[model samples]
Target chain A: MGEFRMPSLGADMAAGTLVAWRKQPGDVVHRGDIIAEVETDKGVIEVEVFDEGVVETLLVAVNAKVPVGTPLASIASAGSIAAVPSAPSPVQAPPPAAARVHATPLARTVAKALGVDVTKVHGTGDGGVIVRADVDRAAAEVTSTPRPDRMRQAIAAAMTRSKREIPHFYLAHTVDLGPALTWLSARNEARSVTDRVLPGALFVRAVARAARAVPELNAHWTGESAPPLPYVHVGVAVALRGGGLVAPAIHDTDTLDVDGVMRAMADLVDRARGLKLTATEMGEATITVTSLGDRGVEVNVPVIVPPQVAIVGFGKVVDRPWVVAGVVVPRPVVTISLAADHRVTDGHRAGRFLASVVAFLEDPEKP
Target chain B: MKREDIEAVVIQKLAKAAPGTDPGSLDRDEAYRDALDLDSMDFLRFVDALHEALGVDVPEAHYPKILTIRACTAYLEAVLAKR
Candidate 1:
């Protein structure tokens, strides 16, 4: 039997409310299938399971808020159930039917820990089986604790942990956006509005390409420093209309062209605002990029999301004096800043990464 | 299409692109960002909807020229007349 645990969608999430299950018992499941919908601070994320198996049971009830890493279901691994017991199954002994209560093991454990009588706890699982949610609900009814905003609380805990653990180094560079804007304008001169690329997408692509050149900066700071990722997943920070922000990854962003990046970014941003992001999109980023250029902020130093070692931020682009070829001239410039985990990389390496980003933008024709 | 007809199409598309936006209250000469709270993505979708609805192709070079309600209608009127 294989256990399917609740996925950690982000570093900040300690628990998520299981909104619904997409699969039921006896269903054949494959890798990468969205098995459940989990509501987090980011939104209702479609949670994907990573193993191939037949679902044996759903361990958590819908609307239950459980901690991350709690097993949500049990599944029979593929090819593991083909051999049946020929005779009386001498190796295994069946429990007496009188003591058998249709309850998940995790639920029974919780009941024991909380000193709650298992027989009295209401069951809401398949065939009236007690699940973790029943214990949680029973506990809640007894304690009457006020429900806090789980998403907000999770984000706070994660950010606090990130700040406490990671030693972050900050660097900023003012890059001339004149060449990039001119190239983009020329490219879009004949295209329709929907087909035109946005500057935010351009920054994402540029940052990805830069990370490729300076591979050291594109990494996660897991206990031992793992090698830089072979491909880049650039997380674009999108502001939700209501209140919170989410930065979902655009997978393999460096390999895509500007137009491709723009399309992916638009789709991701739209879906993110609607709370329809998948688990892969939520947790797969190697690095993150945040842009507030539209808001007209000149410079910003964004915090690093945990596990990921680096974050890049862009501020408002405005025309300013530039010394090109030793002569000062008016040109559009934007401040690009990098917040990197000092444990994995130093300021010198980060400087190279930032410069590479600027270099790509300066020659927008390349990527 | 008449100028009124073009304006109606524009307003309808804007209203659909941005929910809760009062298209009827939009100032003809005010920027959509200030008047309708339409961001760049929403504005782009509005322009695309206009093309899809009325067959008016808005070239990127003319984006600034058609940023406001009055300007968009005027530009669309000229393009439709030519077509």
Candidate 2:
């Protein structure tokens, strides 16, 4: 029998509340099937099972807060039910006072606004008190409005840890995107509105390809050593509507074509805003790319997300005067900035990585 | 399509693009992107939804013409009338 534990969705995630179980006892399960919904600081993540088997028992009750690595379920290997022992007792008891309506003032107000019953909502806050986010989750079953207060706290924790632990160095390079925009427009003209690619996808693809060329930037810094990651799962930072943001990964970004990157990016943004991201997408980024698209910011010096040694930032694409063949001309340009862990790589290597990105963006069709 | 019908489609798509935003609260003449705090991707999805709903092809060059509900209705009505 194999035990399925509560996954650590990110370095900032310490515990998650079990929102619901998708699998039941005696159900046949396969690897990669979503088994549960876990509520974390990021939002409710669809947790997937890695072991293929028959679910023997659910060891955690819904609404119970489970720490990372705590077993939440048991799965028996296929056709080995007779050899396996009986289901183990639940790892945690459900929170007390299921009938009692204990909620924060903000939660009560939100519940009233959203037309959700305070008593019916599960409280995941301290001492099993319902919070505003809990009421939002109860109202919208599949998606919830992330409580700005909680999200801000989460961001504060992660960013503070990053600033404290990671010695960061910043680099900036300006790339002319005139050729890329011209090419993209021509390519998009032939496709349907839904199928058309965006310059954002080109940026992500360029960053992924650049990471492949500079493997040192695509790595996790684990204290004594920073080993390069084999795959490039580029996290795209998406700003949420209400407040806060999430950077979910597009797995194997380096291998995907521009079209694939666009599709993946669109889907990730949709899900990230909807609060329906999966655990792998939440946790498996080897590097991150943040863009302040059309926000009119010329440049941003980003902070590194912990463990990941590097982050690439893109500012608004704007028309600027450029000298070409000794002549000044208007061209669309964007500033690409890199924030990397100084301990892992120096400015020389980071400059080369930024150059590779510029080259890819300048000649997108070739990459 | 009638202007009301087109307006409904825009509102429906806008709701999907930015969930939790109340359609009833939207100012018809205000730029929806600013009103809804939608990013470029969300706006693109809104356009994609408009295409799927109305069979209208909104070129990238014409994005500014549909920035608000009032503007989108006018644009769609013109496109649909031509069709």
Candidate 3:
């Protein structure tokens, strides 16, 4: 039997509340299937199972808050001996509701005061016991709790840690988008609205391709000497309609074309705004791209989200005078900026990655 | 379609793409990104909605020309006239 522990969605996430479970005991589970929905600092994330097996038992009850590495469930892997006999079917009458409801003394009092059924509320206390906070939360459900406030606090904590530990180096390159714009126009002219590609998507693809090309910049600086990730999953930073922002990965972005990236980006942004991001999407980013240019800023210096060595940012694409082969001319230009961890890689390697992105954007047909 | 009709369609589409945008208060001649706080993805979705509504293909080259509410309606009118 293998224990499925609560996964750390990022370096900042310490604990998560088990909101719901998709699979129950005796249910067959695949490696990538979402077995539970976990409410973390980021948001409520669809927690995926990394083990393929039959779920033996769900250890943690719904709404239980557990720290990272707490075993959420146990899976009986295929080919393992089913040696242990199942417990004898309960022959006696079910226990009384008060006897069955394992709750703390404070929780019992709070539940009584609020006229709440303690048995109905899932407990986060020791050995699946109800707590006072759980009772308070159950009582507050009628009043409606705001979601983003907690998420904002979580982001603040994570970004704070990122700035504290990661010694970051910043680099900016102004890429002329004249050729890219011309190429994109020709490509988009023939495509339908659904099939048309956006420049943002193109940039994501370029960044992914560039990360693949420059392997040094595509890694996590965990202080431990770990090997680089085998593939690039570029996280696109999306601002939520409510308040906070989330940067979720479009998995294996290097393999996707601009059209594919565009669709993925649109879907991600929509889901992110809708507050439905999965844990795997939140955890799988090898790098992040934030295009603040949509608000018309020319450039932005970004903070590196910890562990991930680099972040790519883009400012607004605007008409500007540029030098092409020693001649000044008007062209659509975007400032591409990179914030990389100096501990993982130097400015030279980051520059190369940025150059690759610029080159790819300039000749997107070849990217 | 009349310019008003086109503008109405554009505004409806914009409102749909961005849930909280108030089309009534928007400046007709100001850039939609500035006026509506629309990102590229939001703008693209708005364009997609327009294409679905009008069945007119707004090419990438015309994005800048039709960035404002007034310009988008005028551009759509010209496209409809040509068609």
Chain A TM-scores, candidates in order = 0.78, 0.87, 0.82
lDDT of 3 by residue, A1-367 (tens): 7889998888788888776678877778889898987777666677889887788777877656889999888888865636423543222233354457777655654554354667789899889888989998897774543332666887899899888988889999998998888888788888887788788988899999999999877787767743578999999999876567899999999999888998899899887765567888898799999988877789978888777989999998999999989999999999999999887888788889999999998888894
lDDT winner, 1 or 2: 2
- Most TM-score-accurate candidate: 2
Candidate 2 displacement at residue A288 in angstroms: 0.4
Supply the DockQ value of model 2: 0.72
Name the regions of candidate 1 deviating beyond 4 angstroms: A78-155, A223-227
TM-scores for chain B, listed for all candidates: 0.92, 0.95, 0.93
CAPRI class of candidate 3: medium
Off-target runs (Cα >4 Å) in candidate 2 are: A79-92, A98-148, B22-29
Worst 10 residues of 1 chain B by lDDT: B33-42
Alpha-carbon lDDT, every model: 0.80, 0.86, 0.81
True contacts kept of each: 0.58, 0.58, 0.84
Q: Model 1 captures what fraction of native contacts?
A: 0.58
Better of 1 and 3 by lDDT: 3
Error of 2 at A47 (Å): 0.8
Candidate 3 has a TM-score of: 0.81
